[model samples]
Target: MVDVEIIEMYIPNSPSTLIYIPGITSSLTQPELYSTLHQTFSKFGLLYQVSVKNVDSEYYTYIRYYSARAASRARAAALRGEIAIKDSGPVRVTGLSRSGFPNVPLSRYKCEELANFYLGFSGWRSKVLYHRKEESDPLMVKYVSVVSLEFPRDSVSCEGAGLCEQPLASAEEEGDSYIDIITKTAKRSLGEAFLAAWGKVLLIVVEGSKVQVQINTTKEDQFLYNPVWDEPVVSVSEVEYTQDAENEDEV
Candidate 1:
């Protein structure tokens, strides 16, 4: 019998929120300090809000971005260590597993865009690109598959459960080493289970009712539809339709 390994995953509750712990002692009460932090983080992406909190002389800043991809990029860059701040010591940046603020409604359309961006594509309408690499040796060929996914409108919340590492049959049963089994399983399952097993999933909550879950999968049909922004569209016509109708009646 194969023994499966169940590992607890560390999934981020909010991908768009990041936490920054400054090395130097600074006061959040100061306007200049707030401005400096805001300006510094804004270079990575569009920021929805910036806030600072202090507990026991320890200062922490929560920076929220409009797009999860932007927050992810900022976190990756910050993880390299020692982000410099003007008139202060270098600070360390880390992404928050869960947002400290109350739940803010996120547009379902925007969430889809963010997911596609993380997968290394311009938009959900874009085509999936597959790259094949051939080494000098015939046995070393590699196959890469790229997939895009979008959740249904009913999805209310998303969570990361961590990597699902299942063990294969024992040496006595299959005559394969543990390492070999693990390698084969990871490669085969990683691509198909990447979003559900590793990536963050967003949930959409309906008011006064139960929440619905939307799983991320290949959005082949969604390619025909471009995302529509929430903002109202302005008409280009200088004259009103009512005025045009009145002129036609006069004629």
Candidate 2:
């Protein structure tokens, strides 16, 4: 029996990698401010994203780095009057409190977005080991999917499974609806299964100019996979692994 698991991806909840810069009144445009902020903060580490926002009549910028260590260094530099976003004056940097850190849910689409940006097109790959429909009671239909993900460059791989079930049509339903029902159910099941496989907390590490995704499994609460003991009902023939640059769900 294959050890099927679920990769429950989540953003870091503590040791925040995000910093805030308030009272950033700049003569430069928003884009210029963004660029300046990127250039200024990126010197500490590779940045995940940067944004400038206006609260009331004042402007502030948020800088997010891939590494918490980098954020700490940047924060310390600002505190010591060594770093300034603009020549207007030396600015203060503030780190988000542990409870205030954002922990966004790792949806399938977001996972791919981050992966492609950080890991590049050829850095990782995924293959569907099997996607098979299960024979259950007449009132319900179920599908099971097993997939494998590999980061060839990093030499890391893991297997995950997804299971979805839908209600079967009643005998009174039109016959034509049977095909539609099956198709819709199968697509949902496959999408969910793929999400389970793609969803894992990816800790982005940056060392100067190099960046890599490190699978974060230190938090025991994030491992959310439980497998059923049933035998396989159907299996697909050799499915070749493919690299997808475009945003396409493997359904």
TM-score: which candidate is best?
2
Q: Against the true structure, what is each candidate's TM-score? A: 0.34, 0.57
Winner by lDDT: 2
Q: Write the residue-wise lDDT of candidate 2 on 1-251 in tens digits.
A: 43222222555345467888888776777788788888888788656678899766557887876556677778888888887655456777776666455656566665666566567888888887667788987877777766667888878766666667777665226553656666766777667665665654454444433554555544332234434433556677888777666856652
How much is 247 displaced in model 1, in angstroms?
41
Separate clash counts for every candidate: 6, 0
List model 1 lDDT by residue over 1-251, tens digit each: 43221111122235554555554466445566678878887787656567776667666677766545556667776777545665556667755455655543334334444444332243223222322221323322233333334334432332221122343433326776655654554454334333332233433223312233444443222112222222337646586444356577752
* Candidate 2 clashes between residue pairs 3 or more apart in a chain or in different chains: none
* Weakest lDDT window of 10 consecutive positions for candidate 1: 3-12
Residue 59 in candidate 2, Cα distance off native in Å = 1.7
Off by over 4 Å in 2: 1-9, 27-51, 76-90, 101-105, 113-120, 132-141, 166-188, 198-251
Each prediction's whole-model lDDT (CA): 0.45, 0.65
